[model samples]
Target: MAFHKNLTRVERARLAVTKLICPITRDALRVIPLTDFIFGIYISSRYRYVYIDNPKTGCTSLKSAMAELELRGRKSDLDPLNLEVIHYDSSPLKSFVPIFPKPTLSNLIKNNYRFVTFVRNPYQRLLSCYLNKFDNSTAKDNPQARRMPRGAAPGSFSEFIDAIIGQTDHDMDPHWRSQSINIHYSRVPYAYIGRFENYATDYVTTFHKLGIPADEIPTLRHLNKTGAGRASLHEFYDKKSQDAVYARYQDDFVNFGYPYELPD
Candidate 1:
């Protein structure tokens, strides 16, 4: 991971520590069935809130905001450009595992600590994933590229859909994984479910629900912007691709109340 020369002493120290710990921690967590869910979950003991991360659904922005809140200042703010720092294990926002015991976690869940997550329209999300990973020159290096079916074309939206359609969420990368599986919708009692389409307003509402005062609520910084810019859904989706995405992510459509048909 590249570190910015502009990073402060404390930030550099934190990043160094994160680099040392993440590899060991990730290797240990790999055997657990709940690894994905556990890693995605960020809980704030001070604020009594939990944020479940869903990739490609404004996760970077929301996590940065959460980090700001956790630190109690925007000063020496998180570098939106560097994901490693934002996701550092030393951050005030802690993940579920290695931090809370099962009994303690159960009690927190039973006590109704606010659980929150954001999701995007599957149609848009799939296209975004394709554009960001498969369509880019860096496609060959991405792990997802290796998962593509033998004959599938790199950067072909329809082919990308076909590749993931046959795989279960557990086998798929989180970038294109089903939202329901990523959020563990049935397993966790989410107090607020935000929409990426309506992120600007929904995030503020989420912060309010988390009991953050209006003045103290961290601003949602738009970061890691990817996918063909200003591109329309029609540019990527045709009948086959659209239907396949809808079929694969039907649970997301039904659970999140997103319409099946593309918007004009």
Candidate 2:
């Protein structure tokens, strides 16, 4: 309901980060890849838009749309999926390279060319991660799993939450890491931060904020969706487990305006 506000989303986000996140988190977040282009960081040099890709929240789907846009004037050599993959074909569209001398990255953020990212409710995102990644037997086969404390996938959702809370000494898995830590809006500040729950309106609002025409914005592909769509998070959590989750991801809930109180 609040698109095109007098104070922009970027302005509000920068304020929220400074006020809500402690100095320690702000420092930790700043020490990340300058652009993080290798992961979900999608940038369009032509349009001057940056989308910080958060895993489990429409990463591949949005990437597909961006991939299509990348081919606008360039050669249409790669197919949709290949375009999303980080390769030579996609290089021309990238806003910045992941390197020390990142003038392109600095210019974009400093010049304010519409940085954006999507977020989901912390509880739903956790359930999606469990049902999609940690709950599986084959997750240990993932490259990052080799570095996990257990050297294998968490056997259950409860165990996964424990892993997140307990694995302070090791790198936290990005799929389940705190959104506040990942986006670090205080440090970089997004022009628009859309919610996955309100994907329809917020998705449109993103382009609107960027001054992109509605006709040019393509529909997002629903990629890598996990488990039954109807399954409620309430089913997976007991009061105790739910409380554990709240303790673990309290900042996410508080920052995103999500309810953490356990259902009656």
**TM-score: which candidate is best?**
1
**Residue pair clashes in candidate 1:** none
Q: Rate the local accuracy (lDDT) of all candidates.
A: 0.70, 0.63
Error of 2 at 178 (Å): 0.4
Best by lDDT: 1
Clashes of each: 0, 0
lDDT digits (tens) for residues 73-173 of candidate 2: 67657665663453333444454432223333345676676788888877778788777775553643675455467777767777777767755412666
Residue 105 in candidate 2, Cα distance off native in Å: 4.2
Q: Give me candidate 1's TM-score against the actual structure.
A: 0.78
- lDDT of candidate 1 over 1-264, digit per residue (tens): 223447567645654454354442233233222445446767787798878778888888888888777766446555534566466554556533422222133456766788899998888887777877767645445666655655344657766777889886666777878888777676667789998889899999899889899999887788877754357889778898888888889999999999989865
In candidate 2, which residue ranges exceed 4 Å CA deviation?
A: 1-40, 83-95, 104-106, 136-140, 262-264
